[model samples]
Target: MKRIALTVSAILLLFATAEPKQKKAQPKKQEATSVQQEAMKVLMSGFSTDPRFTWKTQQDEAQRICSQYPSMEAMPAQAIQKVIQLSQADLRYPQWGIFWGDWREGKKIVENPRGGRFASYGFSDSPTDKGGNCYACHLIEKGMPGGTMGPNLYQYGKRWNITKENMNTQEALERVKAVYNIIYNSWSAFPCSSMPRFGHNGALSPEDVMNIVTYLLHPDSPVNK
Candidate 1:
């Protein structure tokens, strides 16, 4: 009993004399985040702006959220819905109830890729100078070769049953509106779409978009042939 008491006392004395352990400092995660943000700012500042190609340094809410996650699959359903809602809110419809335009003009825009690009920085921001480059990712024309990045849009109007006869019908108009929404901000229609937000990103104007709609939906368009 005495030995046990002495051993306990010795243990207590040793503990009392021992110094407290200090915790090692953690790596500063926020510091890395700040540095990453600053680096992006610096990179963005390197680009000079022109009339058509303005250097956008900041990300919008949808972009921010999308960037935070690698892909839409990495994001939750709520987050995906949030991006869609934000894109939908910013959608700008065509003015004066004019949804369709000259399909010939639309074909020109679709065939050309140099329009409105940074490469065309010095040129005027005219419709003739800007292009949708739709052929880069879609097979719009039947025999013409196109990129396979996007789906084939051959006979798009025919598939939708849109023709010159019923192009002015209420249902056709609704279809036009749907197409406009898809082209304006594809993410609005599909939250995880890889398609570019042509209107939202300022790559295409309202008039340009309407013309593209015509190219895809007009009965007289070569796309329908």
Candidate 2:
């Protein structure tokens, strides 16, 4: 309870002083620092690890901030800065230069929900035990199905100027970067997003994410078609 109190205190303090709308230029004026202690305190207070699975350790710097300052409405300016810096620095990119794959397969990944990590899963789930679970957060397809935690992604390809011809062009690489950051660091994109850090954990592999990117950019894919 005391730990929670301290955390809650920090949250309140940060909020009591931060000016939200005026933060348009926040990124241009922030410094880097570690928020590990604060994050650990919050995690230990709210998380319990069963014998089967383990409480994920906060490794990435952005995670440390998210774990601690779970509420953006209460995140300190300094902490937010740290989170952005870490996310931008550690974005995981694909190795084979294959950012796009079969969008058909990607759609399946985003819809799956049976592979979340749990303590009863033996400390760690299999590497392949991941899901894009995008539908849980965004209005993806036009009339198919999806969740509303994220904005609609139906015309994502069109919004990004993706077409049958340029879906595989150099422009595709830039799109991949944007998508990667969105998955790995939602806060980096939207300071108060409720989206989970899919890449920060084992929820989605770089390969898996590439497929989703393809789903959004591939011309023949339903998103573009």
Q: Judging by lDDT against the true structure, name the best candidate.
A: 1
Q: All candidates' TM-scores? A: 0.77, 0.66
Write one digit per residue (lDDT tens) for candidate 2, span 90-111: 5676777656777877777777
What C-alpha lDDT values do all the predictions have?
A: 0.74, 0.64
**TM-score for candidate 2, residues paired by index:** 0.66
lDDT of 2: 0.64
Where does model 2 exceed 4 Å of error? 1-52, 57-78, 118-129
Error of 2 at 189 (Å): 2.3
Least well predicted 10-residue stretch by lDDT in candidate 1: 16-25
* 70-170: candidate 1 lDDT, tens digit per residue: 56777888889899999999888767665578888888878987644532345565656677788888988989999888889999988888977889989
Candidate 1 regions with alpha-carbon error over 4 angstroms = 1-28, 49-55, 115-123
